[model samples]
Target: MSDTPQSVSSHTALDQLRQLIQQQAAQQPLPGERELAERFAVGRREIRRALNVLEEEGRIWRKQGKGTFVGPAAPVQPLMLHDLPQRSNLLEVMEARIQLEPGLARLAALRASGEQIALMKRLLERMQLIALKDGDQHELWDSAFHRAIAEAAGNRLMLGLFDAVDAVRREPGWQHLRELARTADRLHSYDDHHRRLVEYIASRQPQEAATAMREHLLVLQQTLIEAINCGEEEQL
Candidate 1:
């Protein structure tokens, strides 16, 4: 391996180096630090630092003894923002939840064991009980409920997607939608839907379970749209 060239400025050199390595790694395996330093006219230390930054950013991966490899291309994981700017735009998350979760629920219905179904049922009941109480502490239970559904699907990729997107679903504005509903009626209706969803899945009807989940998600979409609109109107 050739000697690595020294970079002039730390930040600029690192950024450029990261781009080059990433570009090259996409096409083929990357060379060692010493070679990279020589090609880029930088020092070995600078190449190492640049590679460190890339690794930190999830842009590359390295193996001890074996040379570093290019990281997997980032999947398109768009943030779901609520259209309403005044309310912090968690609608993007809601949109994603609507699109992905109903299918997950349907899958849960088909694939979940009786124990899984029971756990989901318990989560829904816990959420309902918390919703009935005061002080906005139900978000955790809410997340647990949805996460249980995703977990029941038993697909690693889907579960990872769910995990990646879960935080967005729990945004303050998203929680506030349930908190700010005009009456308990909507919340109660949601709880009822949750129970029915669990039952549909437990019954082992994939199509019906999927349909139920979609319908339930439709309610959620309507709720979010209304909340966003109301928030906008209040700002106006």
Candidate 2:
């Protein structure tokens, strides 16, 4: 069948979009449909059709609230961050970390560059220096340390999962529980754990790194549980 004029225009739009995508860096967000239509002198409908084809071809992906990005879609559907807190609890979030982070540490040991390892060390130091004075900043650096490990693991899908789990951990309720659990002594111990974990990764000891990560998370899990139980007892 001969291609109709509109269909021909759509095909042209697809080719233009592919070229545009190629010019973008991986994981970079594309301009919105309105902007792209203006740039290419095409209707929004044509741009949308072109984008859909690129998405189906594994050349682009979109997030809810975030715009379309220049990469193949994630292997699974992205987690719904807003709904996670109601559906999950502190213990469940810690358990999820226990399952995910050790493997990330192991991979970091195997795959992380010297620069990445160095950044982890710097972040650990920042956490220690701020731990006594600034709880919020300490938490921020602590999360950054873990995220550095996840990024060093060199697996985008697992990193996305780690981010989703991390988001749940950041909820105010969970943050409050973590703060309640963080005694000075416990903070010192966590610093030691972070040091050892970073050392293991720096030395490329995958098994030891994984073990250290698992043990650290286990301690955090136990501490949070203890704090929660104590809170409940006080309420009685």
Candidate 3:
């Protein structure tokens, strides 16, 4: 389906006003409220109501003499995990993550704002710091890193999906993979992929972002498969 339009009348009006601001940003500020009301087929009261909502939402700014303009939208709120699946299996987590993460990355590449990209950069730096401090806490940081990216995608629903997968972060196989994945060689490779994906997103290269995302997951999948196979061999 196409992206849902802003539904609440005030919200929709705010979005329309924002779009107008964007279009006219370099040229001139928008017309006065009376003109906007006429243009949108709404009364002046309705325009003022919409502007009030937009102001509260931080989607616009207004000066006493100058007139109203756009504001930076609010940063996305953190997602909470509740009513999600209670599984704690590593294979299940990895499989679900592989299914969901790449698409989110691709969308982020297409839709991410400057604020979101900055947040992602902060997360990457934090991940690097954690890796340096703890040496090989891949299970914790890797899962957090991915979830942070999903959240930065500005899609709360997908963040919740990733959270459900993350709930199994302490499973034995997950720990095993983290241990195996902690080596300097793998860490550099993994971090490289993460950086590349973030860069592609910042550059608004959806195809490259999607490719980087899939490649990152494939590495994890291959590692997990090899680990499972080796375990089976030992068992046999």
Q: Candidate 3, residues 117-186: lDDT per residue as tens digits?
A: 8766765775676554443233334554575567667776776666545544433334444455455666
Which scores better on lDDT, 1 or 2?
2
Tens-digit per-residue lDDT, 171-236, candidate 1: 433444544542467768878888888888888877777777788777877877887788668889
User: What overall lDDT goes with each candidate model?
Assistant: 0.63, 0.78, 0.62
Residue 124 of model 2 has an lDDT of 87
- Model 2: weakest 10-residue lDDT segment is 1-10
Mark the 10 consecutive residues where model 1 has the least summed lDDT.
Answer: 1-10
Q: Is candidate 1 or candidate 3 better by TM-score?
A: 1
Predict model 3's lDDT versus the native: 0.62
lDDT (10s digit) by residue, model 2, range 1-236: 11134443454465467667767778999999999888877778778867765664457999989999998433333333768988999899999999999999999999999877887888888888877675644565677688778878989899879878876776654544675787778889999999999999999999999999999999999999998998788789
**TM-scores of the models, in the given order?**
0.58, 0.67, 0.57
